[model samples]
Target: MRRGAKRLLLGLAAALLLSATAAAGYGWMVYRQAERAAARMYEPLAPAEPPLAYAAIPQPTRVIEAGGGLGTAGSGQSESAGRAAEPVSGPFAFASEARAQPSPEEGDPFTVLMMGVDERAHDRGRSDTMIVLGVNPARGSMLMFNIPRDTRTELVGRGTLDKINHAYAFGGVEMAVRTVERFVGERIDYYVKVNMEGFAELIDLLGGVRVDNPFAFDFEGYHYAAGEIELTGEAALMYARMRWDDPRGDLGRNARQRELLQRLLQRLVSLETLGRTGELLDAAGDHVRTNLTFASMRGLALDYGARLRDVQTTELAGRGRTIDGIWYYEVTREERDRVRRLLADQLR
Candidate 1:
């Protein structure tokens, strides 16, 4: 895999890890209510306060700027670069418009934009992985949609056609959120951002996670075989980073990432994490960033806890093409509309 692509995929795993944290923690709360003895034993493990929420996450503007790269994905295919129009350059500034916010009521649906970024040397890199998760408590379901990192769209605040991932590079979380809102035609009620390094460390903090590799391959000096495997934080970072050897390319890599996240989440909610509560909180404090407040998270957990049993995952469908010597994923308007309708129904 290209170095740039690897960077993005590694960062992507970090975002997924954080999602698992929320799901697992929420699940514990639900379990506590059903089992008094179990709750008593694990009560001390719960955080005294909710995780911190950041209104403005740090976004460094300086670093060695790197060119964009492309990778294979389940729904999108990469093509060689070709002659194309030049993209506009500048900081993005989008005006806020009136949109529906998340309701405190348990049944109301809310949307969260989860971003994993490859920031190096304090320079904020592009959001390598962008997934919009819609949790619908009323419907007892969750919808997860992956937007290819190379997706080409009107960068909402910047008014230029570029990779959707670039929004974070241009304007941090705010721009990324606006660009996605335009793409999906839905108001994002919250956002979560995770740095790659911190995410890697968090994995190590949990000892390690078990993943079933569908194919055997080597990445970053770590040899992996097809079958069930254990990955330390560092090894897991490489595991999520490698996609070049996979026949499915980006798509196959994404599947493994999802698998790891699912398994890691299951591990998080188990009684085992209770023993490492202090270390877990310390890791989260250093690595994770979110806009969701304690009250909101509690509401989501208590109200939507049982509803989380059903989850549906989907990826944006697009064809990759090179323009102006740059690779871009071109998605159709109809596809955008379809996603919009699906989310609208869920939100309603």
Candidate 2:
């Protein structure tokens, strides 16, 4: 080979090596940053308390049994059937200590309870939005539904029937989780709690998101048209918070919240947003708390994400009633059973 040609080839090789080194270093930095952010966001529940005794608590007058056992006809009654027999006790039952944690790498189906808490200075605040997601990678589908903030149910730790959202205000995440598990009749594999106040900043960090608005409405000085619309951080926050004008009230607002979340998730996993990893991690570190570790999160992104193409959303059906001058959304036992079946089926 000519001397000049040899020099040119060496130069190209050196440049390629330098580029590879730089790429590897950047990838490591991102991974380290994610680990740190996950550490910051990690907030596990305190030691699990023994399952609460439901027989001691007062039962509602109406008793309704679900059609059949939550098991196959030929098979004997399932574990879920035993849990369902004692309506009050079964739902509130603590997650079994022996239950194995589902693995994303193995593509095991799992459930996540997402809570959006409206916290303020010196106040713990309530979980204004509670959404349960059942993800089945094998089925390439996800089932999502919102539990109305005002749905009247027995507050697990408090031992009183009240608005479901009050569980957070009364006992924070642990209590909130237990209450929700009772309400849904399924064990939640994980939870992600986001401070609603800081959620705006996180949305803004992602350069905002686009969502389909069901109808035109003006909220908090922002006018949302009846079609697809782009929202800034503040606009999205208000959009999710407005419930008074919504004909369905909290139910309607819940639907909008679901829409916002679905859109946000879609944006978060997009290539465009991946470029802003540092900013997103910082924002999430401050605003979000979850039991999910960095490794599990990476697995979910790499393994289960592409398979979860279908997203189905539904709301808990209930009616509003006033008790002692206070209004509450009341859900029936049968309806709760139906939700349980839906989630169970999704996991299976």
TM-score, per-candidate, Cα-based: 0.71, 0.79
Model 1 agreement with the true structure over 44-122: per-residue lDDT tens digits: 1111221122112111122222365433331222232332333433222212123345673446678877777767777
Per-candidate Cα lDDT values, in order, are: 0.59, 0.64
For candidate 1, the per-residue lDDT at 188 reads 76
Clashing pairs in 2: none
Q: lDDT by residue for model 2 over 143-237, one digit each (tens)?
A: 98888777777788777777888999999999888888767767777787766545555567668778898899997689999999998767776
Model 1 CA deviation exceeding 4 Å by range: 1-100, 120-122
Give candidate 2's error at residue 180 in angstroms. Answer: 0.8
For model 2, the run of ten residues with the poorest summed lDDT: 1-10
